[model samples]
Target chain A: MNAMTMIELGIAIIILIGTIVGFLSAIGFLRLPDVYNRAHALSKSATLGVLCVLVGTFLVFLFVEGYFSIKLFLGIFFVFLTSPVSSHVICRAAYRSHVSLAEISVRDDLKEAIIENNKETEDM
Target chain B: MAIQVLANLLIGLLWVFFQDDWSVLTFFSGYLFGLLVIFILRRFLPTKFYLFNLHAMIKLLFLFIVEIVVSSFVVIGIIIRPKMNIKPGIFSMETTLKGDIEVTLLALLITLTPGSVVVEISQDNKIFYIHTMDIPDLSNSVLQSKDRFENAIKKVTR
Candidate 1:
């Protein structure tokens, strides 16, 4: 009936959902055949999972301290900005370091790009 | 005048409703402060509201909330379970998120979630390196991540 109850429900919902997804990502991380694949599960799912918690917090703050909601909004904005870039950097580093892939991977775009660069250098 | 009052009223209602230490006078004061801040800032900085995309952003927010709740449970489960049950490794992933802001947001999100740590990023900003506490097949998981996570972010931000 009260707003606190609603906020608590929202928070509980978010926590439950986050725990499930995080568990899945962790499972994927452990079970996957190679480092590259494990990276995928960890980065993507986890990023999404945390965002939800932050949002729940944001909503709670919005209801509790409406004036301070803007700050939470900014925090969400920062999360939106940083997660992908770090993931990109990490993935690229793994690629450059020659992390092996599973038998299932067929195409290697970065390798192809490297080959092309070498051939061009030879031609020159 | 009407719009201002409405905005103030809605914001005030939210504040009064959520506060643990409820005080009507304090709530009004806070609301007035917010309004004043917005008024002064608007003059110096013009903001693009992204009004058309607001609805889409809201939808993404909901989806993100779901992900967080699910993942938090995942972390808790890991803690409760034995370390021997864990499978740890690193993986690389491709992404279509072009903007720096978007990529960074994604990385921070990954870090915040349990069992996943974003280790590095590529110079081109197209790939992400991640460490996960558990995975069965790295390549498959990576692909799934791209589909599930990277794509979702692209839809929301772009």
Candidate 2:
């Protein structure tokens, strides 16, 4: 195959990998027994998958027009920075409101912490 | 000190190459100005004697890049999917890293990686509360989260 075709193949592989990971993450969202467990699957794996796709796009851009690759990197940087924080906030909210977990859950440090924190607040 | 001056001179020359303008006086003044800034900063904030080992920093940067790309697709997929397809909730990740800066960097990495965002850091800072967009296997996700990102931070920062 030619060089361009090789690049295309690489990009396609990346996109495919990303797509599959995304699908799995979504499935994890549905299949996981509880919010905490689901969060585990969705955030970490999906992040990995999306990054693969972005790298593919970056590669394509680098080959075709080299101008915007840095900007693309910056965009990727912001996504890396923010996604985890927002997820944390959402989950904390759920826990504070007393969301139920799956039956198999053995330990819950967050619940404990929340309880301890509440007691401290009440004492104060 | 002399090495830093030489390095700055080389950087200034490289800049001139990019700009395609070779003005000796301008380069000299720019170099002086850059040195002045560094000097002022150093005066205010004393330089550490610790050697600048970049191996960890480079590794962290590489891992973070990979994470950003992956999480972007994940988030986008969640947005576009037909179903209200997300199992959103908080989970705490156990960590091995102990340094405050290291933990903060790990937290930053977690947040930057998309679908997951940091919520609360325990007072001890050994545990991180994170929210995820979906779920499949919590244990695997927890392991992967540490292996891929948090563990990498520990290796680098420590």
First chain TM-score in every candidate? 0.80, 0.85
Best by lDDT: 2
Off by over 4 Å in 1: A1-3, A65-67, B1-158
Worst 10 residues of 1 chain A by lDDT: A104-113
Per model, the share of native interface contacts recovered reads 0.06, 0.23
Per-residue lDDT tens digits of candidate 2, residues B1-158?
33455656776776677667777656766676666655555545443211233576687787777766666555555555665544455567788777777787877777656566666788777778665554444334545767667666655544
Compute the lDDT for candidate 1.
Answer: 0.61
Give the DockQ (2 decimals) of all models: 0.10, 0.21
lDDT of each: 0.61, 0.65
Give the Cα error of residue B142 in candidate 1, in Å: 14
Model 2's DockQ score = 0.21
Worst 10 residues of 2 chain A by lDDT: A101-110
Off by over 4 Å in 2: A66-68, B1-36, B39-43, B47-54, B63-100, B108-119, B124-158
Worst 10 residues of 1 chain B by lDDT: B43-52
